[model samples]
Target: MEKYTHLGVYGVLVRDDHILLIQKARGPHKGKWDLPGGSIEFGEEPELTLQREFIEETGLAPITGNIRTAVSYTIIYQYDVNQMEELHHIGIIYDVELLDDQAVLRTDGDGQDSLGAKWIPLETLGLLPLTPFVEMIMEPAVQEESDVGMGTEVEG
Candidate 1:
């Protein structure tokens, strides 16, 4: 059986009551809403990867700060329908912030992987077609707010 491992880094940009998200245009999660980040290049630091990805996907620079690694997880999926190749995806999630709140959307650079980036309301996240990783990452945050009865008020 063919097998491969894909390592990716993602940024979570929460501002006000919204979170930045990209509508994937390619890959296994195409057509789904996901965080604005992508695969880590060889010899690249995870932090740099997150920053580069943010610029590539959203056309906005990430505000330099204490980028915190929030979580890491793995997902398994079929890479090939006929060859039985399995893809093991390892994801790193980071909490990040953008330099500007009103950055206009751009479709250049690595944005080809996605339709575009936009701010999604946190309250309506449950209604979007999100990738499994995004859904998993947001669950705790949602639960925490509900547990405290504070509602969704995402803050940077």
Candidate 2:
């Protein structure tokens, strides 16, 4: 067995009670919902990685991206028929805002990892197969109000 570390930059784009997410086309998270981002290229800045990945995965450009937080998770899986590995995934998350709120999302494969992008309601997050990174960030936000009950939601 072997162990390796993979670091990636991701964005959290939220608007009108919905969150932007990319459907994974491959890798350990294949077919699961993930953040719109990927590994940093050699000699590339983390911010650049976030920007490039967002465009690559969502086909939409972000106007502003600010560092929000970092999170990590570990998974054990078979990388090959004869190889098993422990993968530690470290994610650098950013709070991103789009240039145009109504910009259409890319729903076609990016010829790499993403299948497409979609704006999913926060409340429906639990209904999808999400990557660990998505679960880590969303758990707190979604569960924060669970004990209070939705019927108590105050009208704005």
Give lDDT per model, in order: 0.75, 0.88
The RMSD of every model to the true structure, in order and in angstroms, is 3.6, 2.7
User: To one decimal, what is the Cα RMSD in angstroms of model 2 from the true structure?
Assistant: 2.7
- lDDT by residue (tens digit), candidate 2, 1-156: 899999999999888778999999887788999999999999999999988998888988755699989999899987888988899999999989898877678988698999889999988999999999999888866765463455655343
Q: After superposition, how far is residue 39 of candidate 2 from its true place, in Å?
A: 0.6
Candidate 1 C-alpha lDDT tens digits along 48-149: 988888878888774543555454444454545655545666678877766776766665435478788888888789999998778978887766656556
Model 2 misplacement above 4 A: 144-156
Clashing pairs in 1: none
Error of 2 at 146 (Å): 4.9
lDDT of 2 at 111: 89
How high is each candidate's TM-score? 0.79, 0.89
Worst 10-residue lDDT window, candidate 2: 147-156
